[model samples]
Every structure is written in structure tokens, then in C-alpha cells.
Target: MNHHDPLLEQLNQLISEGRNPDTLHIDTASTLDIVTAINTEDHKVAPAVAACLPDIARAVDYIADALQNGGRLIYTGAGTSGRLGILDAVECRPTFSVPDTLVVGVIAGGKTAIEHAVEGAEDDHGQGALDLADIRLSAHDVVVGLSASGRTPYVTGALAYARQTGCKTIGVACSPNTPVLQAADVAICPLVGPEALTGSTRMKSGTAQKLVLNMLSTATMIKQGKTYQNLMVDVNATNHKLKARARRIVMQATDCDEATATDALQQADQQAKLAILLVLTGLDVESARTLLSQQNGYLRHALKAHC
Candidate 1:
């Protein structure tokens, strides 16, 4: 098999099938005409994702089940895929108050790769195994592999390793007939079709992956009682900005005045989840703390018991 041959052919097909934004006849025609064409193309993305909502939902439910049992969520990818994984994990803390250890992202070339591409890092299957080992993957974890081509060696290896260890694994790819999908327990193939830039999955494919990951992580957090009636009840007030948000969240959830919210937050020692619980149940800090400890740190559960 000629290593260069596949790449050359793929490149040629890419150029042939790619949409030439330059060829678009978007001149000084009425602004309406220009807007129409752009809108038409953008509209295609949602329908593409809509067609696969069932599959995406299935993957999310699977992940939620694992996480309920103390499982972690891990993402594996290379380059743009890796960056997206990291992005999702990082956002969990601020968005849902998840601990950093709950969501792990394994990039192909490690931390250095996030900034600069590491040559041939994607091809290293052994490295993928090593990274998973370092993270101490267990059967209670879920591994998600992201690859546009559905064939990145590193991601495939990580998914394979995770499955072997009795952990649930998911593969998300833009293209059809990807090997990574076949290896994973749940395969999410968002048929965004070919990219406008041909093989550049970072275009439509990347957007689809981002949407799916958002749904997965957000839905999981909600399922775990991190939210209280659509409000973020588990916010971490680690900084001044977050402390302000914590007070606001408490106020919103309990319909308390700003002073009362501030008092609750202070009583809970700046722990937003506990503060919300205390305000909602009208419990003192010690009672709220005991209720939360009994309810697995879920503010909603603690509130239900106390109130």
C-alpha cells in the first residue's frame, strides 16, 4: 500500500468536491441575494444534525448512566478534534461545576499538541494506550473518540483500550464507514456530508462534533442534579466573578433578596451548591451540609429532603 497514494487521492477528491467560496456570485447584488445563499448553506447544518438526534441522544443516555455510577468521561482525539475535546472538558467546570477530574481529555501529542501540531502524533497507537493508562481508566468510565475520517489511530486505540477494560466507549466521526465507529460501543456518525473544503472536517464536521459534545455533557450534568429547575445550582465560586454568579444563582433559585442570598452563600462558606440548598430549604448551614452529605452532594435532593 502506497502511503502517499491514499493521501494524494484523498487530496484530489477534496479539491474536486469542495465548494469554492470564491466562485460564489456574491457581489453588490441586493444584500438579500447574498444573505439568501449564505442562509441556505447554514440551514443545512441543523437538518444534518437533526437527522441524527436519535443516535446522539442514545449516546448521551449511555454516558449519563455510566457517570451516575461514578464513571468519568474521557475524550480522545488529534488536532482539531483534540482541541474540541479539551474545550468541552474545560467548560464543564464553569458551566456545571464539575470537578476537573470528572472529565479528562487526551490529546494525541499531550499538552504541547494543543498549541503546535506534533508530527505523526496521530499515528501512534501505543501512545494512546499509554495516555489512557496514565489517567487510570476504570470500568466506570466512558471514553469518547473523535475523528473526522473515523480512522485516527490514536483515538481508535484509546477507544479499544477503554472497551477492553469494560468501560463504555463512543466514537464520533463525520464520515461514513469509519473503523472507529465499529470499534466503539456506541457510534455517533453525524452525516454532515462532505466538507465545503473537501476533507477539512474542521468545517461542518467540527461544528457537528461540538454540538453533539455540548448535548452530551450538558444533558449528563442536568441528569446528575447539577441544575435546579433550569438554573445552574452547582456553580463554583472560586473567583470574585464566580462569587457574584453564585449569589445570583441562589437568588434566582430561591427567590430570595440579594442580602439573603449573600448571607446564605457566606453561611455555606462560598459553596454555591450548598448555599442554594440552604436558601431553598431555609436550613442553617450545618443542616444544609448534613442533608447534602446524605444526598450525594446533590442540592435538589438535599432540598427535597429538608423542605
Candidate 2:
């Protein structure tokens, strides 16, 4: 029974592949030239992500089902990987009305490392297990382990621990044949070739991970009824800016004028989906709220039920 992983060998191959994308030679070139080159490289991210869309969608579907059944979406990673996971988790609250506890982010060095790296944190496999254990993981939870190299000790440890605890574990990596994938239930690897900079996974690899993270979180929200007809319906109006956006979203979705949308939004206590439901179905706030509840916040389903 050996824990030796083949991913480490593949990682060495990746390093030796000479696929650096970060060595942008912009000497004496216009600022726009540098920008254009960077943009061109960035453009490659989508296609890489597109190639793995099926896997991503599958992960999204599974995550949604788990979340619908009262599961948590937990992201685990280190360094750039950790930052991307944290960003995805935090954005869900403001973007899709997901509760903080519903989408949780756990970096290797904790929250403090979000801005500054903590020395040797990524090497702590024990810390990964401790983090998952501290969360009291359950079968309903979905753990996403992120690592560009796909062999990050911290990420592997987290996924391994999650699997042992009966949680649905997902591995998102940039390299092919990553051991992190083997340790998880679902694996999504977007092979983005090599970074422009030697051994700098933060280059193209980071972009690839970000794109996948965006898809995973956004698609899952769409499945959970946070979106209606390509419109974000679960946006949290936490501030004036968001409140205005919420009003605009409802107006656009319901095809109502500003005054009517504002009135309906107020009637629904600024709940975007409920407000849209009220406007579209001509139901009062209480009835609209009830229908939304009945449909589990799925506006489209509630509309079908009401209509």
C-alpha cells in the first residue's frame, strides 16, 4: 500500500515541456502591444475551458443537486488556486444570493493568506485534513480541490479527506493525468498547455482555473433557480448599487416600466425573483412569496405552478 502518486512525474514533464506563456517580450513596444499580446493569451482561456465544458457541466449538475439537498460547496486550494476558489465562493453571495455558509472557501493558510502568502502552507497535508475536519464535512457537501499542477499536497490531502468523509469531491486541474483527479469523485482538467512563464502556473493555468471556477459556480446557481431565462434572479440587494441592479433585472425580466417594477419590488421586499413573479403573474406579495417558496425559489417553476 503505497501513497506514491504518478501526478508528480507528470508535473515534472509539464515543467520540462518548455510551454512558458509569460515571457512576453514587449521591449520598446507600445503599451497597447503588450496589452494586445496579453489579451491574445487570455483569449485562449475560453477555448480551453470550452473543451472541458461537458465535464464542467457535469460537475455543476452534481453540485446543484447536492446544494438543493442542503449541501455545502467547499473550495480548497493554495496560492493562486486558493485565491480563485475564494473569489468564486465570495462572489456567489452578491451575484446569486447564495448564503455564506452555502458556498465556503478554505485556503491553505486561512483568510489572511488571501492578500499575502503564508510560508510553506501549501505543503501541509495535515493542515488540509484538519481544515476539512474542522468543517464537519458530510455526505451532502461538495468539495472542489483546485491546483494547476494537480499534485499540490494540500489540495490532494483535502480531496482525500473529503472522499473518506463521504463527501462528493471534485478536482479541477490544468495538467492531464493529475493524481488529484484520482482522489476525487469527479475530475475536471482543462489542459491549457503550458504557462508562458516557466513553471508559473499562475499564467495560463490560472486563467484556465478561473474560467472553470466561473462556470462551476454560475452554472450551479443557474440550476438552483438563481437565474431565470439568462437573467440573474437571486441577486442580493445589499447596497444601493445592487438594489438598483435588482430593480433593473426585475424590470427587464418582467417587461414592466420602472414605476411598476419599483412598486412590485417594494411589495416583494426587494426580493428579485419574487418581484419578477409578482409582476409577471399579477400576484400579490404574499401569494408570490408562497409560490416562490413552493417552487423552492425557482421562478420559472413557480410561474408554471401559478399559471
In lDDT terms, which candidate is top?
2
Worst 10 contiguous positions by lDDT, candidate 1: 14-23
Steric overlap count per candidate: 0, 7
Q: What shift in Å separates residue 284 of candidate 2 from its native position after superposition?
A: 1.8
Q: Candidate 2 — which residues are off by over 4 angstroms?
A: 1-11, 15-17, 21-36
Residue 226 displacement in candidate 2 (angstroms): 0.8
225-306 in candidate 1: lDDT tens per residue?
A: 8888888877777888988988888888888899998998888888778887776777777877888889987777776677
Flag clash pairs in model 1: none
lDDT of 2 at 103: 94
In model 1, the runs with Cα more than 4 Å from the true position are: 1-4, 7-40
Backbone collision tally, model 1: 0
- Candidate 2 residues 1-307, lDDT tens each? 8686775555567632445545446455688886776676667778878888888878888899899899999999999999999999999999998778999999999988999999999989989989989988888999999988887889999998898888888999877777787887788887766554556778778988888898889888888888999988888898999999999999899888999889988888888888999888888788888888989888899989987
Error of 1 at 166 (Å): 1.7
RMSD of 2: 3.8
Clashing pairs in 2: 20-195, 20-196, 21-195, 21-196, 21-197, 22-196, 22-197
